[model samples]
Each structure stands twice: as C-alpha cells, then as structure tokens.
Target: MLYLVGLGLADEKDITLRGLETVKKCSKVYMEAYTSLLSFGLSSTGKSALENLYGKSIIVADREMVEEKADDILSEAQSSDVAFLVVGDSFGATTHTDLVVRAKKLGVDVKVVHNASVMNAIGVCGLQLYRYGETISIPFFTETWRPDSFYEKIRRNRTLGLHTLCLLDIRVKEPSLESLCRGKREYEPPRYMTINTAIEQLLEIEQNRGESAYSEDTTCVGLARVGSEDQVIVAGSMKQLLTIDFGPPLHCLVIVGDVHPVEKEMLEFYTFGKSSNQIS
Candidate 1:
C-alpha cells in the first residue's frame, strides 16, 4: 500500500494521528520538500526531530527524485507499505496528483490523508473563504523574466468583487541555469519570497501594465509564518504594508475586493494602525 500523508502547516506536531500511525507502519518514508515547508524547515535538526517522533528514518525527496525517479518509490510500494509525506494537503500541488496517477497506472493502491493547507488557513484573516476567486501564485521576478499573466486574473477577480489570494514563490534546491547547460547540476541557495518583495513586484507589474487591477493604495493583507504560533497578519494598503517588517518566510498576500461590513469589522483589528480606515 502507498500512503500519501499531509503534515499540515506548522511543524512535526501538526501531523494527524492517523498519519503518524501510517508512518509508523511503513517500511520506507519519504518527505516531499519542494512545494512547501514547515516552520522548522528541512534542516538536520528538524528532520531528526520528526524522525525521532515517527520512529522511522525519512528520505528527503527533492524535485528531481520525485519527478525523475518516482518509479523507484512506486516499485518499493508494490511489495511493501510506503509513505510519502507532503507539507500541506495531499492534493494541494499538481505534482502529487500526477504521482497518484502514475501509481494507479502501475496497479499500485494509493490512499490519501488530508490536512489543512494555506488555501483554507488564509480565511483566518477574516476574509470569507467563499468570496475568494481563483487563487494565484506570484513567482519571483527575475531581471530577464517578469511575467504578469496573473495581473489579468486579479483584474477579473476585482471586477467581480472577489478577493484574490496570492501565494508567494518558494524556490528550494533549484539547479543553477549555468550548471545545467554544462551537463552538471549545481543548486543555488533556497529562496522564500517575502511579503515586501511580492508587493514591490505587484506594484511594478501594475505600473507597467497600466491596469487598474490594484495599486499601492489598495487594501491588502500581508501574512507571515501563517499557522505558526508567532504568525503575523497585517492588513493595510500595499504602500503601508511595504514599510512593515514581516520577519521570516512563508509569507502570503491577500488582495481585498468587495468587503462585507462584518469582514471590515474583523479586519480592523489587523489594520496597519488603529486609526486606519477599514478594508474598502
């Protein structure tokens, strides 16, 4: 049996009881480390902490291993119970779905254990989950490549008076372009986009596109280390949030659209200043 388990948002303790049981019963356990991360990250201490609790050694599965060598894991699962752990919900990323599909094609039995992800946890900021439109991911902008395709989606959401949840980019174990061309892989340091950088990039895109989708004065919410004990949530205009230090990674941005009176009242507690106006 192949078990795909979700570790939820924060840390090792976030795993469900059933997920822990599955991990304990599995002969081999692999933790998916590319898409999202826990508060402790993938450090040796963090991995060891989880290993001690689960009573099993975990193999850190990077993108290459998961994408290029998944068959090895599937083969192992064909004869023995194997566990694949994800940071969030099992289906939060498309990659996991593809893995399941491949496993099924190989006649392997697959089971999924669900858990909370940023998609639902973002509602803690007081924005109604039902009012959100299509969620968009904001990738890190490079000097040579700045994609603004998400701008149109945000614009459409705004036109419909629906909120937009912007998931920040997280680049882990990414191979450098220069080394890839040389037939040898050299990975760069991992990068997790901050709320400040995300806002700066959004403003630049708006300026270049000249679209009225959003502006510096637009009401937005900056969230950092969400789901953790020290999580920070600040609601304000994009300009106001730019000056605030979010402190640490795993940040996300919420572009407020049409707001209800109740949501406005709830968001007031997180506004940049007590005297600041409510979300518009």
Candidate 2:
C-alpha cells in the first residue's frame, strides 16, 4: 500500500495522529522536499527531529528522485507499505496527484492522509475562504524572463470582489547555471521569495503593464512561517507591508480585494502600525 501523508506547515509535531500511525507502520518512508517547505525544514538536524519523534528513518526525495525516478518508489510500494510525506496537504501540489495516478496504474492501493496547508491556514488572517478566487504562483524573475501572467488573474479576482492568494516561489537544491552548462551537478543555495521582494516584483509588473491591476496603496496581508509557534502575520497596504520585515523563510502574500465587514474587523487586529510586529 502507498500512503500519501501531509505533515502540516509547522514542525514534525504537526503530523496528524493517523499520519503518525501510518508512518510508524510503513517499511519505507520518503519525505518530498521540493514542493513546499515546513518551518523546521529538512536539514540533517530537522530530519533527525522528525525521525526521533516518528521513530522512522526517512529518505529525502528531491525533484529528480520524485519526478524522474518515481517508479522506484512506486515499485517498492507494490510489495510493502510505503509512505510519502508532503509538507502541505497531499494534493496541495499537482506533483503528488501525478504520484497517485502512477501508483494506481501500477495497481498499488493508495490512501491519503490530509492536514492543514496554506490553502486553508491562510484563513488565520481572517479572509473568508470563499472570498478567494483563483490562486496564483509568483516565480522569481530573471534578467531575461519576467513573467506577469498572474497580473490578469489578480485583476479578474479583484473585479469580482474576491481575494487573490499569491504563493511565492521556493527554489531548493536548484542546479547552478554553470553546472548545467558543464554537465555536472552543482546546486545553488535554496531561495525563498520574501514578501518584500514579491511586492517589489508586483509593482515592477504594474509599472510595465500600466493597467492598474494593483497599486502600492492596495491592502495586503503578509504571512511568514505560518502554523509555527513564531508565525507572524501582518495586515497592511502593499507599500506599508514593504516596510515590515516578515522574518525567515516560507512567506506568502494575500492581495485584498473586497473586504467583508468581519474580515475587516479581524484584519484590524493585525493591521500594520506601532504594534504590528506581533508574533503568534
């Protein structure tokens, strides 16, 4: 049997009871490391923390192993129990869905253990889940490639009075350009897009498009290390949020569209101001 388990956004303790039970029973356990990251991360120490708690040795699966070498994992599942751990909910990223499909094709029985992900955890900021429109991912811009495809999506959401959730980019173990050119494996340092960089990039896109998709004064919510003990959430305008340091990796930005009365009231609690740097 193949089990796809979600280890919520925080630390190893965030694993659900069922997920913990499944992991404890699995003969082979693999942690998907490329999609989304947890607050504690997957460093050797972090991995040991999870192992010490769950009492299972976990194999770290990068993009190359999961995408190009998934058959090896699936084949192992064909005989004994295997558990694939994801930072967020199993299906939060499309890659996990592909894994399930592949497993099913191989006649492997699959079960999913769900947990909190940014999709629902963002509601801690007080925005109604139903009020959110199409979610978009903002990738890091390069010198030659600056894509603004999310601009139209955000504009449409705002037009319909719905919030837009911008999932920032996370690059982990990415091969360096020199390595790719030299046909050798050399990884660059992992980069997590900050809320400040995201806002700057958004403004740059607007400056180029000149379509008024969103302005510097537009209201937004910046979230960092969500679900963790030291999680920080700040509500403010795009320009205002830029001045606040969200601290640490794994940050996300929410573009406010039409704020309901309750949402406004909740947002008021964390609104950017003198005491805006409060941590939960």
Candidate 3:
C-alpha cells in the first residue's frame, strides 16, 4: 500500500492520528518538501523532530527526486508499504495527483490523508470559501519571463465578485541556469516569496497590461506564517499593504471582491487601527 499523508500546516505534531499510524507502519517514509513548508521548515532540527515522532528515518525528497526520479519511490511502494508525506492537504498540489496516477498504472493501492491547506485556511480572512473563484499561483518574475496568465483569472473572479486567492512561488533547490548548460547541476538557494514581493509583482503586471483588473487602491489581505503561533494577518488596500511588512515566509494573499457584512466585520479585526470594526 502507498499512503500519501498530509502533515497539516504547523509542525510535526500537526500530523493526524491516522497519519501517524500509517507512518509508523510504513516500510519507508519520504517527505515531499518542494510544494509548501511547515513553520520550522525542513532544516536539520525539523527533520530530526519528525523522525523523533514517527520513529522512522525520514528521507527528504527534493524536486529532482520527486519530479524527475519518482520511479524509485514508486518501485519501492510496489513491493512494500511506503509513505509519502506532504505539507498541507494531500491534493493541494497537482504533483501528488500525477504520482497517484502512476501508482495506479502499476497496480499499487493508494490512500490519501487530508489536512488543512492554504486553499481552505484562507477562510481565516473571513472570506466565504464558497465565494472564492479558481485559485491561481504567481510565479517569480524572471528577466525574460514575466507571465501574466494568472491576471486573466483574477479579472474573471473579480468580475463575478468572488475573492481570488494567490499562492506565491517557492523555489527550492532549483538548478542554476548556467550549471544546466555545463551538464553539472548547481542549485540555487531556496527562496520563499513574501506578500510584499507578490504585491509588487502584481502591480507591475497591472501597469504593463493596463487592464484595470485591479488597482493599487484595491483591498487585499496579507497573511504570513499562517497556522503558526506568530502568524500575522493584515487587511488593507494594495497600496497600504505594500508599505506594511509581513515578516517570515509561507505567505498567501487574497484579493477581496464583493464581501458580505460579516466578512467586513471579521476583517476589521486585522485592519490597521480599526479595532472598533471587529467582527461580531
């Protein structure tokens, strides 16, 4: 059996009781680290923390291992019970879906364990989950590649008065361009996008497109370190949020649309200097 488990959003302890049981019984445990991350990150200490709890040696699977060399893991699962863990819910990223497809072709049974993810956790901003449109991911702008494909989706969502959740890019262990040409891989340091950077990039795209999809004065909510003890949430216009700093990584942004009265009240609690407008 192949078990794909979600580790939730906070820490090692966030693993569900069933997930813990699956991990303990699995022949091998692999943690997929590229999509999203937990509060402490996958540092040495964090890896050790998971090992201590699972009572199993955890293998850190990078993008190369998971995307480029997934066969190794699948092969192991074919003969024995192997656990592939992910941050957030099991289906949060499409990569996991592909893995399941491959496993099925090989006649390997797959089990998914769901947990909290940004898709649903964004509700903390008070926006109705059902009112959210198709979610979009914003990639880092490269010198020759500034894609605005997500802009159209955001526009459509706003036209229907539905909120748009932006999942920022996270580059982990990405190979340097020059090294790729040299036939030897040299990875660049991991980078986690912040709410500030995401906003700046969004505004830049709007300027070039001039589509009026969204403006600097448009309302937005910046969330950082979500599900952690030090999680920070600030609600304000895009222009206002640009000047504000949300420290730490694992950030997400929400483009507000036609909000309900209750959502307005709930958002007011995190709005700067607007305590009187607290949510009822």
Candidate 4:
C-alpha cells in the first residue's frame, strides 16, 4: 500500500495520529521537500528529529527524484508498504495528485491522510474563508521575466469584494541556468519569499499595469511562520507592513477586499498596535 500523509504546518510533531501510524508501519518513508516546508525546515537536524519520532529513516525526495524517478517509488510500493509525506494537506499541491494518478496506473493501492495547511490556517487573521476568491502564487521576479498574469485575477477578486490570498514562492534545489546549458547540474541556494518582497513586487507590477489592482496604501495582512510558536500576523497598509520585520521564512500576504462587520471585529485584534501583534 502507498500512503500519502500530510505533516500539517508547523513541525514534526504536527503529524496526525493516523499519519504517524502509517509512517511507523511503512517499510520505506519518503518526505516530499519541494512544495512546502515545516517550521523545522529541511536541515539534517530537522530530518533527524522527524526520523526519531517516526522510528524510521526518511529519504528526502527532491524535485528531481519525485518528478523524474517517481516510478521507482511507486514500484517499491507495489510489493511493500511505502509512505510519502507532504508538508501540508495531501492535495495542497497538484504534484501529489499526479503522484496518486501514476500510482493508480501502476495498480498500486493508495490512501491519503489529511491535515491543516496555509489555505485554512490564514483564518487566524480573522478573514472569512468563504470570502476568499481564487488563490494566486507569486513567483520570484527575474530581470527578464516579470509575469503579471496574477494581476488580472486579483483585480477581479477585488472588484467582487473578495479577499485574495497570495502564496509566496519557494525555490529549492533549482538548477542554475548556466550550469544546465553546460550539461552539468548545479543547484542554486534555496529561497523563500518574504512578505515585504512580495508587496514590493506587487506594487511594481501595479505601477507598470496602471490598473490600480492594489496600492501601497491598500489594507493588507502579512503573515510569517504561520502555525508555529513564533508565528507573526500584522494587519496594516502595504506601506506600513513593508517597514515591519516579519523575521522568518514561509511568509504569505492577504489583500483585504470587502470587510464585513464580523470580519472587521475579528481583524481589529490583529491590526497594528493591537493585541494580536503580541501573539508571538
């Protein structure tokens, strides 16, 4: 049997009881490392912590292993129980869905164990989940490539008075372009986008588009290290949030749309100089 288990959002201890049981029973366990990450990150120390708790050695599966060599993992599951762990919920990223499809094509039985992800955890800031429109991902903007396709989506959501959740990009084990052309793979250092950088990029895009989808003075929420003990949530204008230090990786941004009375009351707790700012 092949099991795709979610490790939740914060740390190794965040794994659900069912996921822990499945991990303990599996002969081989692989942790998917590209999509998202826990508070402990992908360091050797973090891996060892998880291994100690699960009582099984885990193979860290990078993008190449998962995307190029997935068949080997599925083949192993064909005869023995194998566990594939994900940072958030099993289906948070589309890649996991593809994995399940491939496993099924190979006639491998699969089971999914679900857990909380940033998709829902953002509610801690008091924004109603139902009020959010299509979520968008903000990728790192290079000098030659600065895509603004997500601008239209955010514009539409704002027009309808719905909030927009912007998931920051995470680049891990990415091969350098020059090295790829040289026929020898050379990986660049991992990068996790910060809320400040995301806002700066958004403002630049808006400046170029001149559509006014959002502005520096627009009300927004910056979240960092969410679901962890040191999680920080600050509610303010984009300009104000830019000056504040979020102090960690795995940050996300929320552009407020139509604020209902109840949401306003809840958001008051997180507004600048309020009690929620003292949470961490």
Worst 10 residues of 1 by lDDT: 271-280
Give the Å error, residue 82, model 1. Answer: 0.7
Tens digits of per-residue lDDT for model 2, 1-280: 9999999998888999999999999999999989874355457888999899888788989878899988999999999999999997899888899999999999999999999999999999999999999999999999999999999999999999899999999898899999999999999888989999999999999999999989999999999988888888998999999998888888999999899899998888888984444546
Clashing pairs in 1: none
Which stretches of candidate 3 lie above 4 Å from their native place?
38-41, 274-280
lDDT of 1 by residue, 50-147 (tens): 99999989999987899999999999999999999999789989989999999999999999988889899898889999999999999999879999
Top model number, lDDT: 2
C-alpha lDDT (0 to 100) for residue 275 of candidate 3: 29
1-280: candidate 3 lDDT, tens digit per residue? 8999999887888889999999999999999988874355477898899999998899888767888777888999989999999999999888899999999998889998888988888888788999999999999999999999999999999999999999999998889999999999999888988888899999999999999999999999888877876778888999988887778788999999998999998888889555234332
- The Cα local distance difference test for each model comes to 0.90, 0.91, 0.87, 0.90
Q: Per-residue lDDT tens digits of candidate 4, residues 175-232? A: 9999999999999888899999999999999999999898888999888888988888
Which has the higher TM-score value, candidate number 1 or candidate number 4? 4
lDDT of 1 at 219: 96
lDDT of 2 at 11: 86
**Lowest-sum lDDT 10-residue window in model 4:** 271-280
* Candidate 1 clash figure, as a count: 0
Clashing pairs in 2: none
